[model samples]
Target: MNAGRDAQAAATERALARAHGLANAFLASLAERAVSRAPSPDEMAAALDEPLPETGSDPAAVVDEWFERAERGITASPGPRFFGFVTGGVTPAALAGDWLASAIDQNAGLWASSPAAAQTELVVLRWLKELFGLPVEWAGALTSGATMANLVGLIAARQWAGRRLGFDAAAEGLAGHSPIVVVASTEIHLSAVKCLGTLGLGRKQVRKASAPGGSVDIAALATLLRDIDGPVIIVGNAAEVNSGHFDDIAALADLRDSHPGGAWLHVDGAFGLFASASPRLAHLTRGIERADSVASDAHKWLNVPYDSGFAFVRDGAILREAFAASGAYVVGSGGWDPFTHVPEMSRRFRGLAAWCALKAFGREGYRALVERCVDHAAAFARWVEATPDVELMNPAPLNIVCFRIVREGCGKAATDELNRLAVRAIQEDGRAFVTGTIWNGQAAIRAAFDNWQTTLDDVAMLQAAVKDVATSLTP
Candidate 1:
C-alpha cells in the first residue's frame, strides 16, 4: 500500500511539471500564434473523448496527450490582437497565484476550512473598495464571474425591495409582490435581467426607460418611476457593452434616493468600473459609490485569471439575508464564512488570483493599463474615421469601437450582407479577431480593447488586417 501511494504521488508531481512546461510554451507562442481556429467537431471528440478505463493511465501521459491534442483547438483570446467580447489576458502574477490556489485546494466556503482564503478575500475586497471609492462598511464577497456577481447584487436588491413591501422574499415566495418593477435604462446588461428573473421577478417586470446616446435619460426615468407605485430596483450600466458609454450614475442614485417608494440601485460595471482607477476617467463612473449594490468582474479589466468577480451591497444584513446557507456541518467559525454573503457553499479559492493581481498592479499600474487600452481604442476609431469604406457607428468614449462597412448604392439588406461577409472574411484571415454585432438595426463590428498585453502595435495590426480584409472584398 505504501509503495502504491508513493508511486501515485510521483506521477502527480510529474504531471504538474509537464503542465508547467506546456503552459509556458503556449504563452511564449501567443505573440505569433493564430488568434483563433474553428475546431473540428469530429477531431475534438476523437482526441478528448474516450471510453472509461477499468484501471488508470499514467498521470503525466494524460496531461501530455491532452496538451498536444487540444492546443490548436483552443481559442487564443489571450493574444494581443484577438479583440472580442471584452476579454482580458491573464497577467503573470495572476497566473502564478491561480496555480498556487489550485495547489492549495482550499474550500473558501467556511472560514474554518481556509482562514487564509477568507483573509485573502477580505484583503482583496478592501483594496477593490478603496480603489473604487466605495464605503468601507459595505459587505461583499468574490464570485465566479460577472454573471454570479449580478445575481448577488440583484438578490440583495430583491431582499431590500421585499422588506419595503413588508415581506421576507427568501423565506416566502414573491407572492402578492405583483409587478415589483425593475427599472433600468435601455443599456442595462442582460445579466441583470437574468438575475431578476432568477429571483422570481418576471422578465416583463423590467421597465426600460429611454436612454439617449446609451446613457439613461434621467427625466424620462424619473417619469417612469413616478408612474410605478410598487417597489422598484434601478439598475445603472457603468459601461454599455457595445459603445462603452457610461450612464449618469450620480443622477440614477439621486433618483433612487428621491423615489417615493425606495429603489435599490445596482450598477453592472463589468469592465467599466475600472475607469475609476484613472484620475482622468474617474468622472465616467462618478456616482458609483452611492449605488446600493455594485457588480464588477476582475477578469475583464484587472487582467486576472478567469472566474473572479465581486458584488458589494451597502447593507451587510440584507446581503446575509439573501444567501445565508445553513447546515449542521457548516458551522462557519471565526465569526465569518464566505458562504454567508453569496450563493455558493462549495467555493474555490478564487481570491488568490485577484489578491495577487491587485498587489502586483497597484493603483498606478491599473490606471496606466486603463489609459493605454482607451488610447488604443481611440487609435482604432481614428483609423475607422479615415477609411471611407468604414463608418464609425458609435463614439469611442472609453475602449469599444463600433463600426460598419458601407456600400455606395446598396440597400439595408445588401449593406447588412456586405457587413456580415466582411466580418467573416476578416475572422477567417485570422490576423486579428473581432466580433460582429447588430447596432441600431444594422450589422456592425465591435472591437473591445481590454487585454493588458494589447499594445499600439497590436492596434495597428488590427487596423491593417481590417483594411486588407475590406479591400480584398469583391463586389
Candidate 2:
C-alpha cells in the first residue's frame, strides 16, 4: 500500500509539470494565433469521446493527449484584437491566482468550510465597492457572471418587496397576491429581463419605458411609476450594451424616492461599472451609489478570468435572508458565508482571481486600464468617421464603436447585406474579430474594446481589415 501511494503522488507531480509546460506554450502563442477557429462537432467528438477504459490509464499521458487535441480547437479570446461580446483578456496576476485557486480547490460557501476563501471574498467585495464608488457598507458576493449577479440582486428586490406586502418572500412566494410592478428601459440588456422572469415578475408585464440613445427618459419612467401603486422595483442601466451610453442612475434613484411607494432600484452596470475606476470616466457613473442593488461583471472590464461577476446590495440582512439556507448540519462561524448572499451553495474560489487583480493593479493600474480602453475606442471611432464607406451607427460614448457599411445608391437591404458580407470576410481573414448588432433598426457592426491586450496596432489592423472587406463586397 505504501508503494502504491508513493507511485500515485509521483504520477500527480509529473502530470502537473507537463500541464504547466503546455499552458505556457499556449499562452506564448496567443499573439500569432488566429482569434477563433472553426471546429466541427464531429471532429471534437472524435478526439474527446471514447468509451471509459475498464482499467486505469496513465495520468500524464491523458493530460498530454487532451491538451494536444484541444489546442487547435481553442478560441484566442485571451489574445489581443478579440472585439466580440465585450470580453476581456486575462492578466498575468489574475491568471496566476486562478491557477492557485484551482490547485487549492476551496469551496467558497461557508466560513467553516474554507476560512481563507470566505475572508478573501469579504475583503475583495470591500475593494470592489471602493473601486466602483458604491456604498462601502453594502453586502456583495462573487457570482458566476453578470446574469447570475443580476438574478441575485433581483431575488433580493423581490423578497424585500414581498416583506413590505406583509409576507416572508423567502418563506412564501407571491403565488396569488398582488403583482409587483417591474419597470425597465426598452434598451436594457436581455439579461435583466431574464432575471425578472426568473424572479417571478412577469417579463411580458414589465412596463417598457423609452430610452433614447441608451439613456432612459426620466419623464417616461416617472409617468410609469405614477401609475404603479403597490410594491415596485425599477431596473436601471449604468451603461447600455451597444453604444456604451449610460443611464442617469442618480435621477432614477430620485424618481424612486418621489414615487408613491419607495421602490427598489437595481442597476445592471456589467462592463460599464468599470468606468467608475477612471477619474476621467468616473463622471459617467454618477448617482450609482443610491441604487438598492448593483450588478457588474469582473471578467468584462476587470480583465480577470472568465465566469466572474459581482452583486452588491445596500441591505445586507435582506440579501442574507433571501438566499441563506438553514439545516441541522449547516454551521457557520458568522464570519462571511458566501452561501447566504449568492444562489449557489458550492462555488469555486472566484474571489482569489479578483483579489489578485486588485492587489497587483491597485487603483492607478485599473484607472490606466479603463482610460486606455476608452481612448482606444475614441481613436477607432475617428478612423471609422474618416472612412467614407462606413457610417457611425451610434455615439461611441465609452468603449464600443457601432458602425455599418455604406455605399452610394445602396438600399437598406443591400447595405445590411454588404455589412454582413464584410463581417464574414473580416472574421474569415483572421486578423481581428467583431460581431454584428442592430442599432436604431439598422444592421451595424460593433467593436467592443475591453481586452487589455488590445493595442493601437491591433485596432489599426482591424480598421484595415474592415476597409478591405468593404471594398471587396462593394466592388
Q: What lDDT score belongs to each candidate, Candidate 1 first?
A: 0.88, 0.88
> Across residues 28-136, which tens digit of lDDT does each residue of candidate 2 receive?
9888878766567888888788888899778889889888888657778888888877899999999999999999999999998899999999999999988887889
Residue-level lDDT tens digits of model 1 in 55-80:
97788898888888887688788778
Q: What is the C-alpha RMSD of each candidate to the true structure, in Å?
A: 1.5, 1.6
Q: Give the Å shift of residue 115 in candidate 2.
A: 0.6
Off by over 4 Å in 2: 40-56
**Index of the highest-lDDT prediction:** 2
Model 2: clashing residue pairs?
none
TM-score of each: 0.97, 0.96
Residue 352 accuracy (lDDT) in model 2: 98
lDDT of 2 at 213: 90
